[model samples]
Target chain A: MRTIAFAVALALAAGLPAAAFAQDEGPSTAEVDAVIEAAFPGLDEEWAARLAPDETMEQCNASANVPSDAVFEEIRARAAGTIVYPDDGVLVGSWENGEKLAQSGYGMRFSDYPPRRENGGNCYACHQLTPQEVSYGTLGPSLMGYGKLRDYSEEAVKAAYEKVYNPHMAFPCSMMPRFGTNGVLTIDQIKDIVALLMDPASPVNR
Target chain B: MQKLMTRKISTVALAGALAAGLALAAAAPPAGAQTDEETQRGLERFRQMLREDPWANPALLDADRGELLWTTAAGPKNATLEDCDLGLGPGVVDGAFAQLPRYFEDAGRVMDVETRILWCMQELQGVDVAAYVKRPHPSGGQPVKDVGAIATWVANRSEGEPFAPVLDDAAGRATVAMGEALFNRRSGPFDFSCATCHSASGQRIRLQELPHLSQPEEAQVAIAEWPAYRVSSTHVMTMQHRMYDCYWQMRMPQLEMGSEASVALIAYLVDKAAGGEIAAPGIKR
Candidate 1:
């Protein structure tokens, strides 16, 4: 309790003085380097490298999550580089299974080590995918009538797939997890999630 | 952290014990021989079971947290919040929660519990409530601690209390009207409204039942409960948080936390659930 109190006091002290905490010629790359390096101390070599802000994260962080169009394009291009299209050109999967994938919010936690349970897209966590879902979190836009509005066009289906694959490809610094790139969900799972958003028969449309 | 852990352990144990007890009490055979009194007792036991595991009974937990958060205090004032009136007299946390979104003459404006808490935090503790809302929880990557706790504590106080928001007052009525409009106004990539899930009864997305918030019983259950403990997120989320989150899911800009829209929504829901019992400090799955 005392330690927490002390930390809070220190935070208050550092935070209360506006001028002291104000930006001074912006954060130096070294400062950014230090913060990023310290953030991942014990991870494996590959994971540790991920701690280093890619060009996208760096620009996003530098601009405080608001990037100019050029910067946004750059981030999108870099993120787009990570995309690996499926061997079969088809992006849409079984909407029935897709609905299940979108609804289930399991996997990705450290406890799911050895990857026992399959990863779920958990799309409903941040969006109201279906009007009837009561358990969803409200972070992203509701996906109800997604197919109805878009006419389930091939372009829209492709866009949804890309958005789910790496949200930064669509909107830079998007809070949505890069389900495909992060290995959190498989390509097939991404297809299912896409189907959930675009399938006419899916509850998302109903 | 130890204290938090201990509290969690005890709460889980208490819930387990209560669930086992209720199961035993409610386990009478489904037979024609059972008397009315026995049946009533069995039903009471089942309700108790529902109470112990509130997440299973979503309505109970929401109001339960609201009641609990009503009394606890954690501003720089270092004082218990028992005296901060909710339209009603000091420490009167009963029907006050339900009747709120009503005009408070002292505050001279209509406010719901979340906004009300923001008011108290500002007035009593000198905390910059707005700043707190703008920044994510002070402990990033960790659970939000104080604000949610305070919110839940206050909410828990009026569990079983009836909802009676003062709709006659100009401001109160205006808030309700605005909330009603917002409930149906859909503006997102998908363009969904609250009506999509809760406007009708008997709607189930999958396994979960979407309660009709328009009905008094359903409304009462929802408005009276909240600031619920969500098992998936493992965070005790406040109603304001819930509302903003809902907006996010709708793919809309986050509601300015504790803004008019948020409070008005609360008023509308609470008004809908006028006569239901208040239950606070609800546990959820």
Candidate 2:
């Protein structure tokens, strides 16, 4: 019995039972929802609504972050439908302004309520574009020399713009956030981030 | 907003703390591959410092205050929490934490130590303590909530014992199942579940190492030391605060204190840590 218990412990530590137990004896969506509702009492309705998983999230959750090919395609399509491009045809903005946005990790938190200033992209939290900043996370790829690598083409700039706005459009179930679709970043903010990535003169390319 | 500590915590002192913390990393082996030579050596030196002098650490201040909080009569009921039971029978704190996250008959659910404390506060003191639920987490050397301090003291009781939560019955099974699903469920604007950063072993974000909570061995070591005093924030953070902080980072709404979902998640994580040694009031960075 002790050996069996040890084996179970070992399996859990190695993440071997992740798939099998993910499907077994799990609570239904409704049951989970009930628990969530009971979990947060003081949250305003606007904030509480975020706790509920939409169709996209529901599919993603059911599959354990790796949906089937059909579901993956559907998620991309559904997420794509939510994208709202900038009113003007311009895809890139000032890299200088974008640099500041990239460094900040403000907004979206409950503490930032009542609106103090413009929201930040918090880009540096996950990616390292500039060599000067030693403290940066490796959750996302380093886009250093981004424009230089792509030959600074117009099409590459457009792709960069879209990628910043909605990372899921390019890679489904990607660790990157849906900045544009979730309204975490404005069209202007995203355009500026694109400039940071696509402008050869920008630090990312330098 | 960043609280400007007038005296910027010196880089040299923080470096020393980091070296000490690295000692803890090597003392416990990871459940998966984590072959980093530099970290291992640093961890060895760090443990040496702890062995030299455990009393110099500051977390003991919180534990000191917590001991007083346990016996003192306060709240609306004008009563102390000393009579409260922690599943080792009424008023029996000895080895109670080691066997917690168990099914409580009165509550009809599985609850971890933090949730049990909240229950005792409400029942024995009539404190209406729910008013402070979901308040912003204290940081940057700010004062922590009472829950953090009390948890530190309670967890200190089983400092060396292995976890042994009771989970043989149906209610225990049901709560753990709910928590397991909750941990994996993707929701909110970010589409992030707890598994996004933690399910995988040997992964990290920036300098911080991420443990895979899905595995029992890893879960046992990681979760066993909550109500930890973080060097970066300089606050003793309880498990409830950790849940709140994670949800906030995902841009999800606040997790209500002592809520079923919170308790359920704790139940799942604590059960995963079974057989690991307890080392509460743990110092963190």
Candidate 3:
């Protein structure tokens, strides 16, 4: 039986197109989806929804995070539509609160269910925000002296808010979470993070 | 996030204490102002020190326990796992782990180390697989599960042996193909696949370097280290547990223990890690 299986595998490999060996020939999307669903048997409807990729995520996955130009524009536009600015039209909040939020890496995890406190932007996890924080990730670019580097411009501040609100709006397929659009952070919370990046008084600008 | 939170708090406290101590001693640059290179060098030194003293790894204790479990009889059949086949023939163990996640003819599927062990326990010892699968992983500072311990022991036996998974059969190829697709398939709230964090080299999440698993060199080095002793959790974590935890962190629902998806991911990793030397029970920060 093992010999037969090996012979068949060899024949399959020899006869099939190169694409067959590529990701295209792997389990079908429906099959992979079924496997994911089966892996988490007792998940609630809300949580189960997360297992299924959103339309943008599907495009990103299909393209290996490099969607076609048309699809890219579609994702960016869709993401832009999800951004909800605060009623006050003020993009920046207290730098102090922003600093605190940047420092906290809490919420959205399974253990953070029935959250005891607010969700954090977890900025330091992927970016160098403040010079004082030596231990920061290098996934994203350093944001040190962010506002100061940009001369604390109003345009920079608004841009910071939009990026945080939905990173895909600015750069589609960015690894950063969609904090505001995904409901991981409140509109006010996003304002605070914008303050962290664009507030002249914030340590990031120091 | 809880882990990251704890780390953040401790880091702040450590920086403050260092600042005070340095002020009393002599002038210093600033508190927590060490450059990224300096931090990376410090962590590398710490890891090197740990590696130099192989006996210092706490995962060995779990491996010792696993050895005991392997020899003892306890299940309904009251049979030891001596007769178990781990891709090698029954009762064979030496260098067995390095070539696993292979196609098992009897099982008619591809299974990684932990899944294969579960199969053995059920078939040979009449163990209740469901009950075993449902057992929760140990919390912080607690000991790993018996299966995890067992996997550590088995994998340790293959230490220094190069990974040589033979995915030449139809089942093996199919499983690995699924694994490759899954690794890049983005899902969940954060739009993350395993590739999101790991596809790129030299990237990090809070000072933790993300390995580009798509690259053979990085994949080999990374995969070779598991069943590792996680310093934060203070326990030996098996590959299955690692998958479960990662999915949890990705905000996805729990990945069932020894599930096909879990096995496929491992198979994919093992294939990527081919020719990489086994360094089981390696220390992790």
Candidate 4:
């Protein structure tokens, strides 16, 4: 008794239709590791290492990114522990450099391998920072006048840095990737991005 | 700074629009006195309209070709795939697509639709496994591989069945687990995993709507509609090809066809799409 016809169906779903998704049980890490080795034939050592998950990722997969409150807290706390602050106390960098970082959508993709220019933060992919760009994405809250909204407070700038570093530190299971944690951008690059968000003269605060 | 950025942005947009307009004028004659943007918008709308009417889609022809390939004898042995087993039974194709990436004792591993076809090619038709493994995928207007045709036809047979694979088994569950891990694993220079693009809802790269595959409902819709014919590519693309294309766009090394990694990824998607109705040979932009 199938209801809700599928979109352009070829035939059916899987063989059985108990219709209950397997939520309680999932594949074990060992099971996953063996499969990874097989699926990606001749994988490089670096790529193979990435396939293995840390505590947060394992827990996230187990829960399908919807963990219990206790599990959520554990994931967030573990993620926060991984964050490393910059050696220099100064939180902001040249907004000019920051603006360029924001504009760029390069770095980390396989095509950029062997290292071209410095890695760009690719901030505009998700956030609207300046009114001048009509084609900005809306996945993140608009940062138009971000500094003006916060009155350029030191704490606000630091908070911005933390958000960019690892969003899970503040909000668990966030869709945003851990750019700083993942080494997509360096500490200096992150500080410049913060400047883009906090500088009074930056187009973001225009 | 704000004024300068705005001026620069507007100038860039205007310049791009002018170039596009010139290109379109050279490429196609306007039906009326419509601007290039308006004509482009109309073409986009027509693509959407064709999606609503299956008769308008050119993909159905490929699906038809796939059906003929299934029964027709192919390869060195000149044997019809009637003897090939899809784990349903020998030559039993009905509802087979929905229960794929399962462990087969003969193959000694898990196999998806594409991999199983490769198995049959070697076992039944006596073709050299190296040939298909060495062959590269063809793009636009090129004759698609036999596997693509066969996958489309097989998927077509199970169109109405709800997806519910047996993950309770040892090898099957392990493969699914590997799939889940790979889906979340971030590699390449961009630091992206599939989750970066699909974990969240209401996300898009440019104009394309990215379905969040982690959510069960979304997973059901997204996974089922794959192995589709794309208007953009002008060729029928299978689920494996879709995965291959994604990795390519991610700037990662190409995923080998019928490889363990590819099969594991399919197993993971099938498990996620459990209880979802089958939808294949779908039309896509």
The 10-residue segment with the lowest total lDDT in model 2 chain A: A15-24
lDDT of 2 at B67: 70
Deviation from truth (RMSD, Å), model 3: 8.5
Quality of candidate 2 docking, DockQ: 0.32
Give the poorly placed runs of model 3, Cα more than 4 Å off: A1-24, B1-46
The parts of candidate 2 lying over 4 Å away from their true place are A1-24, B1-52, B132-140
**DockQ metric, candidate 1:** 0.02
DockQ of each: 0.02, 0.32, 0.46, 0.19
- Tens-place lDDT per residue, model 2, B178-208, is 8888898777766678887788776656456
Q: How much does each candidate deviate at the interface, measured as C-alpha RMSD after superposition? A: 15.1, 3.4, 2.4, 4.2
lDDT of 1 by residue, A1-206 (tens): 99988976897776453322443222345543443344224556644444354566557655545789889888889879888778988988888898788767666443345677787877775677776665565556767899889999999998898898888888887756677776767898888888888888888888
| Candidate 3 global CA lDDT score | 0.84
lDDT tens per residue, model 4, B129-184: 76776654667766457788778778877887888676658788767766776788
Selected candidate, larger DockQ, 1 vs 2: 2
Most accurate candidate by lDDT: 3
TM-score for chain A, prediction 1: 0.79
Tens digits of per-residue lDDT, candidate 3, B69-176, equal 888997999999988899889978889999898989899889898998899999999999999888647778789998888889899999999999978687888888
lDDT scores in order: 0.64, 0.77, 0.84, 0.73
